[model samples]
Target: MSKSKSKRVSIPRSEAEMPSHVYSQLNTSFRSQDVEGDTNLPPVIRSKLQDLFAQIEKEFENLYNENLNLHDKIDALNEKLEKENYNPERQQTIFESTDDVIPVKTSKHKLSGSSQKLKTAHKLKAQTSKIVSSFKTPSVVCSVVKELRGHRDGVWDVAVARPGVPLVGTASADHTALIWIMESGKCALRYIGHSGSVNSIRFHPTRDLVLTASGDQTAHVWQAAITPDYNKTGASSDEDIEGGGEGESGCDTDIEGGGGTSTLRTPIAELTGHAGVVSHADWMSGGDLIITASWDRTAGLYDVEKKELVNTLTGHDQEITHVCGHHSQRLIVTSSQDTTFRLWDFREPIHSVSVFQGHTDTVTSAIFTKREEKVISGSDDRTVKVWDLRNMRSPQATIRSDSAINKLAVSNLGIIAIPHDNRQVRLFDLTGQRIARHRQGHQRMVCSVAWADEHSFSSNFFSCGFDRLILGWSIQNIKDL
Candidate 1:
């Protein structure tokens, strides 16, 4: 009786009334001053309390605005679905050819011995065999043949060496650029010269030189040597060479350990003119000049031989994200954080020839098709837009994705590989038809994807991401279509 004398019953509140407890606590804190002898709080304490109340009010306002935005997004998505007449329950795959049609499987045990029946049975068997063969001998859409693991930090970019070189270069957040033997996936050489993370790296179009852009506000051109220098102790496959320090073995300029090939950390040429971090650098078709994009809201064209800045393309209102030289045309495409992509003529770097402005957010990446007739760009708005250079006033097509895209790679076989923030690498045809999608291909955001070579459309490409993994994927044609 004594133990149960004064038990306080607790009642659970409904979902709508859950905030009553919080309101009670706030009321108690404010009413305490009224109950106390000193009804007025100290000026400092009162000011602090007012600031806290203001912060809470601002937070609630932000949450309300966010809810409104989300509701509008949902409505927009519903409108798009209605416009497209998309019916998930009755999804159909459109086939371009009759060869993709296959008959339903049925029991053959109940068939009669009539000649016509036997002929029909033979035809069915042949069709089944052909389909099974196709399944067994499927073309490589994507296969992870190798996993290059040397960078201790996230790899920001990767570049495959020219055909027959069997080498690949990687720019890493660990403040170094590395070369790997493509065949063995071994760290063949390491270039350590940047004071900050290497943002982008590229092999000279036709030379043995590699150009690397760094967050240190500089780009370096390094000499890549394929000769095996066994006399010098090479760095271990997993070791990272310090950018400017001597090795533990007292080697001031070279890495302590060398791989099959050697990459001197001492840069042959340092292109340092940008006031902000350089994000991207690419060589012109002939490798005679280089184009770079920087956070300083400018893109610069530099003479490779003269090692001097030629012209700075200065029209972007925000940071320039990426720069790419056209394969055949003299045009250069530059993507920017201002939600637009600009095409600048290298011959006339002072002005942009055409500006594409449809993306709602930052334009993170852009690339030119093989012949430079079209440009494909990916934006933080989760859309891939194709713009015909001939008509730059409007986009030719818009391909929507579930997540924001980081990079895009176009193959010669009309396949486009887009790595997105959702950790998916999707393949689409030039017409925007989704060919394939590798969901959760990496554990984290995929930063970049590149076709291994011109002949790589048969099923070879490389991808690197924030997961610290470099994966090789092969593309396979759909078999059960």
Candidate 2:
């Protein structure tokens, strides 16, 4: 072999780069003379190359599947972030914008049919213009104000004084009733005589007297000087009047030495009789009779002139929460934690004239409106309902609120004030249209709301769970009555 060494034929660099097995197979399939001259590769070598291509194809498929799975994971994370970003305090807007798309064509040769092309372009332009014009803008307007703080220990009740007077009364679990002045934005006075938490306070229709119901099982009358018109001199010049002949001598003498202007600060009387806590009390239209509801499941009528409890009305199976005398003085309405509202005839010593039983939760407050022919009630079921006195079997209208409604007051201008647990004071017209919403900064829950006049309103809204702060709001507007 050394004598005539057969030099190994060198393969081209491109074929030499393959595996030695592939090169060996290629070499075995063809003669050296034929491989040098032939343009096509051997069948065996081609088969090996095909197997390598299939392996690469499978690897690419696996990589593509992994990329798709990563994409799905990213999409899931993005959706979760979007939901977290949504804020309930912000107003939601639902509107879309439409912008027409136009296509442009560029060619070396111009169109031979100019009329057809021009007509098509004009049609497209018209369609785009129409779409742009039809696009709508958001038309809804939302109030920028939000709820402030609410009470913590639970707001028992609220009342507003007469117009132009910046005073509001709030009863609370703190065992006191606070008088707030809007002008000074400070608590003007605290009526602190009740041994327990005060449940309610109501301003007299004409006088500066305020009546408060307390858990101490008693009601107190507070006299605050609203104006100088109140008699302070205590001088009786009409001693021999018509109805006041000889018996008036004692009455005149009693009124003569009552005091000067300080008499207005003295409580007119303290009415007591309820076996349980007095939840609510109110003065009648004439300011002569006071109606009070108690947790003993009974409501009582007090004769202010006689300074004695007149009648005891008992029917409710649970605690009585509220009571109101009719504007005509012929009837009375009451609400209870037993989920019922009853209409009573004060003159007839019989049964209730009608019974309202639609509320699914405890009725906490009730008021007679429309000259005492209709009644409005607020309940823990988060609803405010209006009912006709004639048909108390069902409610005529039910307005749903965001939270439990504790108090309802119908303003003289036909606006209804609803104080809710969301620390909001809402104003609704008789038709259930929300006209205004005020954010109260109470830290706990808003217990009550009342209107002093058409142009003024006050809330005895406070929170004990917060900082034991009481707040009052006064709003002014130029809208027609």
Top candidate on lDDT is: 1
Candidate 2 contains a number of clashing pairs equal to 16
Clashes (candidate 1): 14
- Estimate the TM-score of every prediction: 0.66, 0.57
Query: Per-residue lDDT tens digits of candidate 1, residues 1-481?
Result: 2331222222222222111111110111233343354647777787677678778857765654454344336545644544344332222222122233333553464333343554665575554342223223223355667777767666778777777555677887777787766655656567777877788888877778889998888888877645442223233231333321223332323322332334355676889899987888998888888999998999988998899998888889998888898866677899988888888875554554677788998888899988448889998777898888778777776777656688688876667788875556887766665666675357656788877764333326788876677887656553332
For each candidate, the alpha-carbon lDDT, in order, equals 0.67, 0.57
Model 2 lDDT per residue over 415-452, tens place: 66786654456766555555555543553345666655
Off by over 4 Å in 1: 1-140, 228-263, 347-352, 455-459, 477-481
Model 1 gets an lDDT of 0.67
